[model samples]
Target: MQNKNHELHVICVNLLATLWDYNRVGKDAEDGDIEEIISMASKSDLADQEKQVQENIHSQITNFCTFMDQILLPESKSHETTSQKHSTAPRPSGLSLAIGRNAPPDTKFEIPETKPLTFAESCQRIKDLMGYTLELKPSQIPHEQAGQGLFVDGEADVGSVIALYPGVIYSPAYYRYIPGYPRVDSQNPYLITRYDGTVINGQPWGTGGETREPWAHSNVYRPNPSEPPSETGSDRVWKMLSKPLEGSRLGFNGEVLERRNPLALGHFANHPAMVMEPNVMVCPYDFPLNEKGMRAYIPNVVFGGVEEVKMKRFGSFWFKSRGESNDGQMTGPVMKSLALVATRLICNEEVYLNYRLSNSKRRPSWYTPVDEDEDRRRWS
Candidate 1:
């Protein structure tokens, strides 16, 4: 398994005192009284320590991002600007990609180690090389009540980073703000939590977009409780967050970004079936917002207020199969976000991920435990 996908895994299991504090405060603090607690947690000494780890995470994610940027380029850049010529043709969605044939024998696939690059530099180089982005056709999931699944427009190698989960990032401190609160998932299936307590509400970010735009979301959408339905508890998605907000104004919580990063659709990935193993796994990627230039490709915004909360520690992943979730890797404190990296080479087929639901909770009819032991350990 040379170049095994997620060899770095992107998870750290340190006690993350600040992270746990947020988790505790989010669940316990009375509404409107949490700002001070969160403020204190954000400035903790541990928070400073988390920043150190974040630096390494920044390097690791960019390395993988650039690596994916290189191998996913399947067309010859010299071939008539394939990205523009094929506007109607399928492009990679959930991540940026240019149309290309697989690299020829002489292409320089190896990135030089002597020169380290900022994420902005790596992203810009890839953008200049590949012109257009965002193409894909989803396939209807084969089970009853299942939603459509994300399908890549082109092939990617086994270790490639596939789609990024785009949306409003809600750290543990602000979990109460998520519409539906303790039952957030009841009204929104687009929510995904990191190994740490951070939660990403993809409900605000649809399939991304075709061009760059400034963005933010309420992170406060909940289902319309009174809506009529054909079946009991049949449907929700009411009181929703506004679709990707657009404007030229910049703020502490907003920025213009490309919506077509081919990997922006990680939220669209569905759970694998009982007999099927997941082809991709979730990795928490901490994006450094300080890099102004790279903002265009990152499809996310921090929820208001907690934008400054620095995660000081990480928690364990519930999955035993993900045994690599070790505290020895305790790394930086940045705005933690989620992304899906391929576990094996993925062709233009549907992408599947493990939801790893808690056994104590009521699961949907279609939900099947990927591993029974994992469910117990995760919720234990």
Candidate 2:
């Protein structure tokens, strides 16, 4: 009976964490909301509920919660006391479906540092935390390109999710505020590049105003001027080059970049040399548009027989375009995370990414243009 109770407790904790991870429950979930979830889990029998709940949903929720508890929560707790003292007191709940107040003062979203791990170990750790199976490995490039790069250990079809670029996500404002210029600029003082090469930086800012010094390891994409233009788009290149460097262009918002960590393997992916085709692309993870919609996605949280769950889990598991709508407004929900996805069939060898596009004048040559149908097929 004691063991059973413990199992139930773990299950309940996981369910709650999954809800939070998928944004079904806000990070600043009220004690009452958590109690309600606990009550529901405790009163219900897994055997009885198993028939109604989808197996994938159950597994995903359990894995997500476990990752949070084992990895994120410990780091959060370290600063919890200080944050709690500085945070505003929790407000009363009115039984409405609104999001709760701001997360606890100490609810810093910083990715905790881990001991240095080898490329293989880093990949395994990422897989463990994210519940995704990855087969890529870090290998050295030969000759002039003598540097570490990620290679596919097995065959992967086009549009498959290759890997995730794990690092601290920073908003444009926060990135700019980081003390000192980017490593590239510091090394070559004459050349300074902005994030994403646009007139305005579009990366999302980190919460709580926690800042770190900018270093070479920071994940920034800057174009190399010495590289020749792609043969396919010579005309377009000429047109772009002829135009003045200064002009207003569409810039992305909720855009984010991962600050590479020395211990992360994803950071080793090298930029494409010259105009070679790339196998991987970086994409943003989407978040719900509103609190009500977010809450509706939580599993098993029915209200008066109205089931509101939409997705099995929350993540950038799907590809969404950052394009503008007909009215020139940004479409889709605000993005929160970034992912590295396969653009073409990747074989057992080193993978390359076209990290060009420091300026928005011209699109990078290696970009695998995906239509709505392609996007659907990739995620489906």
Candidate 3:
């Protein structure tokens, strides 16, 4: 029995390795490679030990192959880049790379290539890449009250990436010129007006000198009644458009800004209604700086230098918690895009997040902060 178990393990490992190699070659697995594995399994004593085990083996192989086909098959529109085709050599492991940390010495990180996709296709691709499917639609909780929101279509384990906060980026100067523009307040959802000068209330304005519809208005703010008011005794409002400028006498120009992309489903995500722990948190998209000719921010796994595991899990795609770096020195380029990350297990649940503009007060009742130590243990 021991020998049979060992043999089965070896066969499985070999099959997985072959699949990995086939992926690198940018080709589908040959029938012979797959048939040989099945043939070997059938001949092995292990298959006789348990009918269930045999069935499991068959199922896994089929699923793996199907996944491969989706990736390897050529798209009608070719999206492969020169760098990706040339860098198709097999890596030592399939583990997902950790962001925020410096690449190991002499390690060259390569961004994965992607094809141009319509908004629908992009949402589907995100679902495929993360193994989690989410839909942004009218909330069952009554649109008259809670508004449209995001719900998980399938199980999303803790640390899974829920979605990217897609939108057109704008500068703070653009918002300044709008007359009687509501001051940044705690009650309002973050707003990014459309490039075409459309407002959230469906009014049009030529403030930004553009004539686009407002994308930020698509995301509705569902107030969480269970959440306690600010402990600081002041209304905490977050401004989505402005941030303190670095090393300039202009005294913190709110230069960084973004409006929700109308095509992105993330715009429909709603705020938490009752203050149970929110499953999602927002962070800046970290890999492949915007200046690198990236047309849009899409969530995909990026491989780093280390090769320790086969198939890095979904959690590896987002920013991990890190202590202040060497003498407070900043690492690599700053990220321009924001991403929505899962902070806890989110299986078929209506996802919620704290939309409070201020990050100062703790909203323990409504939001569950990421436990760095726990996150490390799970991933490590």
Please name the candidate that would achieve the greatest lDDT relative to the true structure.
1
Question: Which pairs of residues have clashing backbones in candidate 2?
Answer: 83-106, 171-204, 171-205, 172-203, 197-358
**TM-score per candidate:** 0.55, 0.34, 0.38
Who wins the TM-score comparison? 1
- Candidate ranking under lDDT, highest first, comes to 1, 3, 2
Give the local distance difference test score of model 2. 0.34
Against the unseen true structure, what C-alpha lDDT does each candidate score? 0.51, 0.34, 0.36
Residue-level lDDT of model 3, residues 105-201, one tens digit each, is 2334342333333334433554575465666667754336565667887666543445554432322222322223334223434343321221231
Better of 2 and 3 by lDDT: 3
Q: Which stretches of candidate 1 lie over 4 Å from their true place?
A: 1-140, 218-253, 305-307, 310-333
**RMSD for each of the candidates:** 17.8, 18.4, 17.6
Flag the better candidate by TM-score, 1 or 2: 1
lDDT string for model 1 (269-295, tens) is 888876877787765677754443244
lDDT of 2 by residue, 1-380 (tens): 22433443345334533333333454466888867865665566655443222333334333333432333224544233322422432321111211113213222232233333343443455455553434433444333533345666555554344543433233321222122322233332112121221111212121111111111122232233444545446435433432331131211111111222111234445555544566765433332223221121121111111112122111312111334445765443332333345555566767675444333244434333333343233223
